[model samples]
Target: MKNTIAERIFDFLKDFPPFDVLTAEQLIIIARNVKVIYLPKDKFVFKIEEEIHDHFYVVKDGAIGIFRKEDQVLVDECDEGDIFGLRAMIRKGNYILSAKAIEESIVYSISSLLLEEIIQTNTEANKFLIASFATNTRNPYANDNKGTLFANVKSLQKNESSLTEVQSAQYSKNPITCQLKTSIQQAALIMSTKHVGSIVITENQKPIGIITDKDLRLHIATGRFSIDDPVESIMSSPVITYPENISVAEAQIAMLQHKITHLCITKDGTANSVLTGILSEHDIVAIRGNNPSALIKEVKRAKTAETLQHIRKKVQQLLQGYVEQHIPISYISKVISAINEAITQRAILLSLEEMNTPPPVKFSWLALGSQGRKEQLLITDQDNALVFENPPKEQFDVTKAYFLSLSEKVTQKLNTIGFEFCPADMMASNPRWCLSLDEWKNQFHSWITKPDKDKILLSMIFFDYEMIYGDKNLVDEMSESIFGSIGSYKIFLNFMGLNALKNPPPLSFFRQFLVEHSGEHKDQFDIKARAIMPLVDAARLLILSNNLKGFNSTIARYKKLAEVEPQNKDLYESCINAFRVLLRFRTQQGLKNNTSGRFIDLKSLSKADRLKLKGCFKPIKDIQELIKVRFSLSHML
Candidate 1:
């Protein structure tokens, strides 16, 4: 008797881990006895110390999160076709860990007795499960035998292992809820009995307000209220609530913004919704991984620009760790960029609060130059601008003044955050740079149409603009307008192409690095002017010529170029490698001297480092040659 449902299960299971090792006939036999279960988001499939089910489960859809109860660590996330619930069944003990649906899902459970019988005689299958059990988390669907079984092997002080500040905060599913009218005596008893510090006052299963020990201490212990009073009488109304899918960064930000210790987890992310769980601040720091994402956490709590500046200084340490860890420079850039962006966002939000009122029009803050490109590994001067929505003629001055004042505040905060004020006054605080959308469009038009040397120089600097805060749509429109201007004035690209080759790879006639001859620092290599800028210039030219949108970082632009021009894949890849090496080399130098790594003491470099630097220049030269031919710049050459 072939069951149709079992046959469908067999077809799906045969493609995933552990089961992939079994024969079709054996999988069908197992599937016939499989029990399918549905779990809503945030629902626990199995909880810590809970009795093990007879079967091990595999995700048929959505994701299952395996959390460590002891530390509240999101140890591993099981996605489609990933297996869970096996080890406990294998050990035949109460679950030491908890498995919950991170998303709504259908899970197929194969009976443990049948699974053991099926795999016992199969040596390879047994080895696979044992290895998975050992690792605690093997992505069996992946070609590599990587898993997270021993992820909990760290000591109690293992907060330095991996940063969980970005991972989801596993909330207490069973929150202590009491009616708003419940006597303070009853609520206090519940808190003592449950060993919890907070009690949520709910109305019709919805969180309305909350009472914590602090509220009790400040109100009751201080003789302000009696225990016999209603819980609502002293409760803080309108609770802070987050959805089930809050990340550690968001949770940290929310807590910092509200200055609260616990957040109610609700279904629809509102106080009016049904309460699902409670996320305590302790749950956040408990799973804080070794990753210096604590910088992001700290940035959230920053009250003044000085605090952000302090946090920015600590970011270098995180950068040093990533470099020491041999993490890819691209990934390092992303992490650093996220931190920088977060600091900027908090600064803007703080500035908004300081303003008399919010800006009258939508506006976006743009980070230009290195900060804009997100390649500013070392602390550098802030290069930013603002583009506000066009206002009616009568309201333009008032609106512009409000934004300029706001920009001034934000820029000052950013300066304190370690981004030095741009010497050229290119920041949003500069009235010349802070413009209406129409003004920015006109500005971009002039830059594209006219190729004067100063305009050309500024054009290149401005083209790498990335939105740091505000309405993203303005940035999109700005991009479309810039490209539109280029389409009309196609000759501008040639001038831009010429600029890309202005700083040739710094090699002397004899191939020695062309170090500075008579500058303030003689015999010093200009990594930025020579190596870094050439690749940056080439990426900008090639990507802009292709009219691609949104590829801002030099490395990202190169990767995109490689994808579009597969013929130059090796060249693009080499350029990417070279850029990373140069970027890191500069970063390490900057760290050592506490100055921008723009200049390198050539005499200090080793023979191998010299060779690596020399190797990077070839791609620089090759790319420039391509840019020259593409734009017909041989005559200028």
Candidate 2:
């Protein structure tokens, strides 16, 4: 009997792993007994605890879900070229997982009897089986316990999955090691051969100390010691050792704690245990790619503004990937905020290097408006302030002039990086914003105590100011001043609360969006100012009343408010959830249209999106009710 279809199956199988290692003739022989099968969506190929079949299945098309027995949790989805059900078959055990077709699918099953026969004689195939089996033991696809794996597999092939948060970090398992008795020359020679900067010194395979190139240069090359010195003479003893399972963050912390660049990983997480590997700060950093800290380091290391510009572009690319991967919008915002703050700091650092004289005293750099709130998603206007420590009477004018010039350069660079200077000139470059810490306190004191309509409007915007870069003491001093002033002026929060309720959610009497009465956006609703800012401003006002100083973000303020006041928990939780949805919607709209996303077309949204938007209004209404009662704004109205 000629197995024509089995021969075709063998041809496809020979091109992929494990099977690829099998000889052409060996593969064709196994293929003769292969089972060609098809499954419809939701049809089970095998159930949990079922006895193992003689054959293992390989997906030919569509997808098959391998679900955990409990709660029917999907562990992995096997699509084309993916193999499953083999481990149970080869081990002669009952199936621990259930496999069902996620979509109508076709598969080919290869007999384990034939697999064992071919693998025994074929060394390459045997080795491939061992490696594949080892990987399966680790449960590489465990995180996708309930997720559709097919959605991620296509991107995996393109290497785009590496940018995703779900991707696992790759770490070194086999570390460079040497005996403590080895001469510095021998260790240095080994390092040079291996192209490594650091080597671990061990005793009976237990990590004892570490020696890096820096030590050799500082101790040996400077004529202080000879090249024949034992590696222990210059070795940094009592080396830091972390578990072999250390996360990227743990590795970073270990590096900082020891003030050393390398960490030894051991079997049981102690210096007495056998060394399994070394995790260099460089290694951790390489795998920590796309994080906020890494991006900042890249910006600092950048020799040219053009290089910084390129890193900024990568930041945007990372942001897009985060959004597409469905990372929580709040988390995405924090990471981007950190990157933005780092960029500003790097710009400041570079500008200081360019300046002839250093800043005279401690100062605070404030990001005013949306950026101050850490809510600036797109590159919007540059709204910032610089508050310096009060200068002596003699140096006042000279110090002020010098800092102002520095602010101008920093602002210009920020403008180049896409943050447009505020049209109203609300920047540190403006003399009004750049002031002494005492002056800023006095400025806020006047606004809070007096509180005219204009002053109230200014206070509402300025009160959320976040310190982007500067001396911590200066920012802390400013916050203390604001809180102190507010203590004497309890009415300020009432006024601020009244101001927040002014916009009224932008919904008309018929539950339809109310477009602007007149302006460039006359026919379009102002989502930012009307729907978003009012809620953000209200959250800040409410939280500040409870003596919260640093709560800048709207959602975070509401969350904190919920924690302190349990009676308002539901309302605050609703606001946080609503804000997340709105933010997600705005970012999606902005990405699609390449605009500010402040004005969303009501007609453009789907029925489900519109329904979700409507759902958000319930919290908006409830919060406004609380504000009206607490502020006595009903009398004001």
Candidate 3:
């Protein structure tokens, strides 16, 4: 007998996971046995400590929130085709969470017997189940798990290789060594001859201590110890040691934790063992070619903007590799950001050398917009400002002139290094942007208090300010002042919230993408404006409302938001996952097209690619709704 309801259920289930992996006959059999249940808003499908149901549920429509018992925090939200109540059923225990309909919901309840009978047999289905059990969410792109449950499953198995983090570090097997009785002068000559920074002090092939260029500078050069003195007189005692098979990650952590540059690799994993080799920070940097330390070293050594430009080009290539390799976006962003900061610091140093005199007052170089957020992957226009300490009124004009001249030099250097000048003249070279700390505070206060369209736009960009160079105190003071202004006029957040909602996720009622109707990007999607900024704006507003400071990246803010708002952990986690996907997608697009990945051609995407892109939209919509309610923006809008 043909069953229309069962067919409909199967249709919906086929597009989703676990069921998607099942055979048609297998899904049909399970769908026919499914019991359809209706739930009103706030109605619980199951409560904490209740006996486990015979069947777990799949949401056909509306939303079901799984709440923790102790605090009733919403740990996860199940929407259309989302499965819930399965973990407890699998474990055969009383429910640990209560599943409630946050909105009127229709759910398809499937018996556990059928799950065990059919779904458990399929490998893909099993992987999905495992991910769901582990993360309590359907999406396999959990922050901890880099990709989908099925993503790279075969490639990972076939490769049988480890990432750099886990791969065995390549240490220098032929370590430069000297006897404990060797004179400092002799050891120094050996180091110079070997072109090495450190020499291990050994006895019977066992390392007892070590000395480096720093030791030479502090002891011999400072006249604290004579060059003729024995190396033991200045050698650092009880050298840190690791085994021959130490991984890169372990080596880095050991170095940081001990505050040492060199580690003695031994026959065994302890100091008592015979020294096999040495691993220096430089070795680690060399192993990881696109490493932060290596890039920063190059930046410091850069004599001209042309050299920095070459380094920045390498950064882009590094970024492309990271995206292709599926490295975590957070890790990539931090490394890239550190490199960018180093380049800017070097640029400032070069600029200062060009100036006639040092700045009359202490000042900070601020990176605005994406650079400030540490989320910039592709090269984009330069958005920056300058903030200097307040000088005496009489010295103000002269101080301003000096900084302005310095800003011109720095901005020109950055331009030469491929950070194109912001078309709107938002760079620090602009007199309007280069200001004293008090002037910046006043500027922020005006924007917050007045609240206009242009001001709000400026606020969205400038509020993400981070100091690339100069006095930390100045940036801290500016943050305090901005927050102070916002606190006095709480309504400013509403305007920001409204602006966030302006570019809603680029989807229409028919679920078709809403691409640009007219412009150079006609029929193309502006992923940056429509998808990325909404999340960025919402995160900034929420963080500011909480009076939180120092969270500049959208991902970091969302993580912090999850920490402070446990009830919304699932939502914030979803946002983080969504943002990461979008960011990675944009970066990949940018790299492929050789343009800023802001505009995406809808026609160019494969079905799976489109689905992946569409997957990110839900969190943007959810977060905007949260912001709307939180800030009371609905009425104003």
Candidate 4:
């Protein structure tokens, strides 16, 4: 049996990753054979191209740097509970990079023979080995690029069909033709009846010209040509033509180069030949893909709740497509945001229609928390607030009741759609969150001026409020009030800045992750609170200090900061990149486990992923330093 020290180590490892997959007895067995090696700072464990060792290493304490000879770059750093030196073990090949202690560190070296024996029996452990050995061949968070994860590969494969077809282009098979002498009004009638955005103008069953929505708007609508004018008067002559066999990709490119959305498929591949069909961008999009915009339109036009549900299903398909394509998380965030916003707006519209009376005054719908920041991926509980215009004292109770009823109806529809009610009853349906504009302003004032820990927490949750629907003026007025309050209480930003530094990047006691010391989630890393939120809260606080409004998104704030401070441009850009990597990792993990990717089981992550994640924290440390110096927050700490 392993000693208490090794048993404790095994206990930590088992909760996190490959160790977690092993039986407790198996872990204790492996732990007994572990060589706990300590190294001084900057000591090399192994050099690049060195023969593979019989064992791999995991950071038990402190940080270890994995350096690549090429450019002498510090590829990644392995923190507490992070694995390293395993790729060589998996491949039985020489080490590709050198591993060195970045700081004073203790590493647990597990015998490869023992690992193999465990893997042969442990399916989960073996699968993890394969994953770690494959794509993680190089540091994903190297100086040059943020690494893509397993989820990226899955997302790429998923989006392949639509992306492939988009590159190839799909054309209509049925051609709507017209004689050259056909009156513009008649052609317009046919287009209207067919519900097509563009129509082909043909003569003798041959291609001639094209008339599109743009043409009609420019010529007929602008009085450049009369309704009775010959179709040739406004039709685009020598239309952009492609052969019938052109792929969707080729067709899309051809249309783009010609600056047109419609591509005519002709028999002889020329404008003079017989026209086979017209291809619209919309047709191409509908054939092989689902787009968020199309889904949004469907949501708006949906006649029934079921139809909206269908559109929501389409949104999921789009999300799957995006995730598979390895589309940037920011883009995915925006697309999801638009779809979520559309659903909420549609729900509100449906509720309004069901209501017996129009709202007495302008009221705005607010999306709180992650949804408000437009970062929600998987559906979570609804966090909403309502801000209605203040009414006379006599009508106050009545107005509040009316909005409460509306909130109840809206939240119910949202629940039906997907978003569950907030467990704490923090939703707009709650009396506290559903308030008048003046009341909200007062709330902000109280939170900022008389800030206590609870008030500060409340402010953090409430400050991220995004106006979803209703009068623009009301939202703008609310923002103005916030700025006015912040301007008077500059210390609010300092307090917020201090809050951002609360987690200290979770670097080890020796400049690495301070892994969970015990319990159910023991050794499982808390990546969210430690790595992501510090950056998020910092970005929000920093941006607010600049008096910026309506930019709650972390990336957008960094981009804005980069623009405003040219001297600190590189730092802001780095923060953006770091934030993206961490967010992407969290999302990928969340998707994999079907839970919030906040607490990461270290054993499950490949040696490379663990290192990449550790690499992301460097910028976090740097940025925290900047925040400290800038805000004079050292005293508070």
Per-residue lDDT over 250-309 for candidate 1, one digit per residue giving the tens place of the 0 to 100 score = 575566557688999999678888999998877776665323346778888889999888
The residue ranges of model 4 lying beyond 4 angstroms of the native Cα positions read: 1-167, 171-196, 199-281, 303-310, 516-520
| TM-scores, one per candidate | 0.59, 0.64, 0.68, 0.64
Candidate achieving the largest lDDT: 3
In model 3, the clashing pairs are none
- Worst 10-residue lDDT window for candidate 4 reads 148-157
Q: Considering lDDT, which of the candidate structures 1 and 4 is the better prediction for this target? A: 1
lDDT of 2 by residue, 498-571 (tens): 78888887677999877877877677767787768767977988888899877888888998999999998867
What lDDT score is found at residue 403 in candidate 1?
A: 93
Models, CA RMSD each: 14.5, 12.6, 9.7, 12.0
TM-score winner? 3
lDDT of 3 by residue, 39-80 (tens): 998898999899999999888876687776432556555665
**Number of residue pairs clashing in candidate 4, backbone atoms closer than 3 angstroms, sequence gap of 3 or more or interchain:** 19
**Per-residue lDDT of candidate 4, residues 1-637 (tens digit):** 4468777777667645667678887888898889989999889889988898999988877677787653265656566666788887888889877999876889888999998998898887776777666444322211112232121221112235444432435667887778788899999999899888887877777777889889999998889889998998888888887767555545544554475778888875576777887888787667655655456667889766667767776766565544543445676787688789889999999988888999988899999888888888766789999999999989999999999999999999888776788888988889999999999999999999988888888888887888899988998898899899999999988888778888887776786567788987888898878888888887888888889887888888899988887888867876876787787777777666767778898787765577678777877888889899999999889
